[model samples]
Target: MPVSYIQGFDPQTLREIVDVRHCRERLDELGDQRSLPALLERVWLLKVTGDLDAALAVSEQSVRVARMGGPRKDLLRARVLHATVLQFRGAYAAAVQELTTCGEEAEGQGWAALAAFAYQHRGKVFYDAGDFVNARADFKRALFLRQEAGAPEPELQSTLAAIDAAERRRADVSVAG
Candidate 1:
């Protein structure tokens, strides 16, 4: 398959839908050190399939590639993905810091949707840290940005639902107290 045709699909989504042979074939066709999204997806595929070392290497390369300069939003996306990879490594604080910087940079760049992406991840990290309040706050910020950008909401809805559930949990705790 032509690399362009293969690139038309997200590798992560493609991996789920296709066999390992075809997926690996596509990855081989696409080659390593490709575009930001492809690198992110490759890293994600490795991460999902229990290839942490490869994922980490791809993620680090993705970060470097993003930093080397392309679109600001793409850089933000790579940074966010790198932060996510960090989370898998048990570097939660570093992940959050990277996410926070990405969010702020995206906000400054006027990339609302990218900022939302950063917020969503930051919220997940905060949740893992047992900081429900901060988690909800970050999720809300992400939700608001996604809405403002007129982005689709299937994923955002889940985040909002999570925030609502967190609020309910806090209220229940208060009542119990």
Candidate 2:
């Protein structure tokens, strides 16, 4: 895993988007010799900074590494992260496709938490695409699964709020129509 703190950076700065292209290029040059954790970290940082293109590149590379190393957990994570990057880039359908695949894989592996995360991200993509009904359902499923998986309280609360907001928006649309 990437260190939560980097030198010369405060806690908040740890997530600051820097030049991830350089890091990605270096990792690519190193090929299979590169560290998985480091690559994941760079991918995370790039995604956080809204550099979707670079993040996608790193995420795809991470998938390859995970497949080679036979780390199913890491592979699922990379797929979900890549989907999230696509969502942020406004590629809702593509993001949904990616998340759907991740969800299937997670379910197959009996990883409820990962599956829940995939559903949650996919729900957000639906919301972005204005598919409020599907979004609400997916978010609710995510909330249920996340709760059963004993995920953090903050995440649960946030998902709940999102569901509520989406529902309210949908209701308003119904009334207006």
Candidate 3:
């Protein structure tokens, strides 16, 4: 499910369908105390609501569940989403770590689109931190992967422009020095 859709789903509907309490009850009923998807959903909700600490707590839980389940795909998604949350909170170094792990996992899983998205997000984090060199490198990688995956052009174009601008600024600074 798309993150937007998941986030936009009515809380009432969630209560009826996949409430955390209900999920916990179901887990108890099933004698399996791990509800990875539900936990991830909660974390995403917390993130969208700008509750970083709550989001981080749930994200950590989701990572543990994904690890125990040995589902690389879910693990990659969780890590990438967690990294995005961290980036939004201005935790750049931690975001970089999560994104690097996500990239490695995506590469291992042969998920090109996911890898590209991770790179794009990591680049944005670097860009926000004023680390234009690393930002340009990451954005370049994202552009390559996105192009290879036949992604929409407009998105890549904007990022490419940003990278170009950053590089030009760096060049200007070097010349001025």
lDDT of 1 by residue, 1-177 (tens): 123323232221111233455556656765765887788878766654556788789988988888897777777787888887777677889999999999999999888988988998887777666566887799899889989888776656666775775566557557877
Of the candidates shown, which would achieve the greatest lDDT relative to the real structure?
Answer: 2
- TM-scores, all candidates, are 0.76, 0.76, 0.65
lDDT of 3: 0.70
lDDT against the true structure, per candidate, is 0.73, 0.74, 0.70
The true-versus-predicted C-alpha distance at residue 45 of model 3, in Å, is 3.6
Model 2 Cα shift for residue 38 (angstroms): 2.5
Per-residue accuracy of model 3 over 46-123 as CA lDDT, tens digit each: 665556787787788888888888678888877887887787688999999989878867867778778987887787
Candidate 2's TM-score: 0.76
Window of ten residues with lowest summed lDDT in model 2 = 6-15
Clashes of 1: 0
Clashing residue pairs, candidate 1?
A: none
Which of 2 and 3 is the better model by TM-score?
Answer: 2
Once model 1 is optimally superposed onto the true structure by TM-score, how far is the C-alpha of residue 93 displaced, in angstroms?
Answer: 0.6
Q: Can you give the lDDT of residue 3 in candidate 1?
A: 30
**Per-residue lDDT over 1-177 for candidate 2, one digit per residue giving the tens place of the 0 to 100 score:** 233322222221112334446545644554544577767776766676566787788888877887788578888887787777787788888999989999888878878888988998888788878788988898898898898899888678767876886787789789999
